[model samples]
Target: MSYSEILSFVQFIHYFTIIIFLTFNITNVLSIYEVGVDYHAFGTNFTETAFLTQYHISNVRSIVLVQLQGIADRGANFVTLDIWFGSEPGKITDEHWLATFPMSAQETTNLNQYAADVASIQSKIDDHRLHLNIALFWLGIADYKIGNLTEGFGSDYLNASEFTARIEKTTDCIITAISNIRCSDGTLLVQTVYLEAEVMIGAKPNQDWFISTHYPRFLNQITVAGFTPAIYFLVDAREEYILDKDYIDPQYPALNGHRCMYWVYRSLNFLKIHQLPFPKRIDFSCYIDRNTSTYANLTYHILNDADAALSVLDAPKSYGIAETYYFIDDTQRKEFGQAFALEALSNPRLSHIRFWTTPDAGGKGIHIAYPFAIEDFLPPLKKISIN
Candidate 1:
């Protein structure tokens, strides 16, 4: 029989086995609020388990942690698996790349090093009992070790056709990597692959076809491959509250005929130059051939306090502050923390609020010295005196 037939038969048998297993032993697979720190917490002094244990806030912290063996122990069960697939340097191939998994599919002479990198993550999680809900894959951030479609090389493609072929391979590699990295139960340790579907971190590519079509296709392939594609939206609502619009809220600066507010007239409601037609996107079912709604469910990451101001209730599925340290003092943190935690508790959907050691991020000194203030970044509200 052909490989395709064999694979299909194997998949059928696998499904049948699963059905038989479930038929005999049935239980709920519902996921709970995997609330905890990200991979950065491992080495950084941002949040230590002691903080949760030592400083007990209101009842809001009830679900924060009950006990702690480490960052991933007990109540703090969530952790991040930030892997670099370009570890193999230049061993690019359709089947396997030793640089990543190291003889991942073949007999390795260097058995000790084979997949030792990724294997270590699995070992750590198993030891500490962590649940990985995000893939902060530091793509294109490391050294110039690869020349493939992934990492920092994809956007270099001249056109959509070229980008399609290149990104499909990257997606294939990503799929393989996700499949390879599993927990002791033989399930995916890393959920929600951070498919940028836009320019990856530091991947400054020509926006021509990359954004227009290349990225759209990339995310589509990811969904079709039986993975729930995810992207992050770092939104700040402080400006919105002050100006009644966030930059991305189709109002600030203005797009699709949005009103640009310049310090709010301090009072006047900005006006849109033109009211554009609503754009319709492809349905979720079209990608994977399943019955679904026209609504878009997304996962969001709020890195700073500015990001936390937005209404996460809209993205009820998954949304939370990943790493927020802009609080001026302990008072600010306590006040803001309590309010944020309280709101998160009410939201049945879930809000990922991470509390690390508190020294590096929340303790000692934390300020918004990000080199550019929000107002400074805004386009100069030009004056033209049309009278």
Candidate 2:
């Protein structure tokens, strides 16, 4: 065909693809509803009234559960079941509590309870108005108590099969319960799985290496079971966010800065596999020494404060691995005016780097701020690596 014909064909294909994509997305938009919050350890404390009120203003339309109780009676439409694997009925002790893969008899009993919980929750969903989308078993509990994190999964720790079985059992329970519901063919239940296997943050090694190394192994299993992945990255930060004894775990971060900092490193590395949106842009100026006169001096400031620098440098993205750029006003740049400090922000190794000030600030010395940190979490950095 002629060159014009090829161009015309290409344009036609593009528009056709666009039309199909738009239609698919529109259908999804109309169907899917998300509600609920990250019910991490707040499992028992959650009340439908309190929970709904919290997100009512935000218009959240989906639910993500870390624990289950009398939610079914609460009139919830969509529920995301965070099927946890840990402990058994009766007096629970640390030695035998951690449920391993393949599941021991006691562990099986625990899973039975999970199934019962789902039935109860689903009964509520069935009784409530509207449809429901249930994400089965979001891996295990978002804490270190579930497994031997230091050694990682398998042998002495979690077995992929155990997690799979838990999910299977949970799904089976839902299916059976829904079938038994003489109360309706009214509630529409769409079954999907949202899997997550997160590492803890405060132990000696914190199982960081073990969890990271074994992450893909478990994640692949989840996918093979046909589950979608969800983020529990913030769970590591929560020990710091909620200060009460109930939420406070001695093995996790207790300060907001520490929590935010944990996410920075953990997320940066996790981004290598799964891309997520970057969180709101936290200002570098907040952590850096404000009085530093020049860009070179600012560089010294960063070099002097390595921990702070890493926390700022490795800030987590809001969504999966999208490119991000940070803007610095000329005034801030003047701090590093013609020096290595200025180069630090301009490092090509970083994702997004912009050097202009926004009009809203009216060009005042751009004071930097982070989302959670009221104060510095870590001691000043002693050594640094820009890479």
**Candidate 2, backbone clash total:** 31
Residue-wise C-alpha lDDT for candidate 1, range 124-193, written one tens digit per residue? 3335355454332223312122333343332231233443454455556656545555556765555555
lDDT of 2 by residue, 29-100 (tens): 322222221222222222222222122222222232322323333322333333344433243443321333
Model 2 scores a C-alpha lDDT of 0.32
lDDT of each: 0.33, 0.32
- Which ten-residue region of model 1 has the weakest summed lDDT? 281-290
Task: Compute each candidate's TM-score over C-alphas.
Answer: 0.42, 0.33
Best by TM-score: 1
* TM-score computed on alpha carbons, candidate 2: 0.33
RMSDs, each prediction? 20.7, 17.9
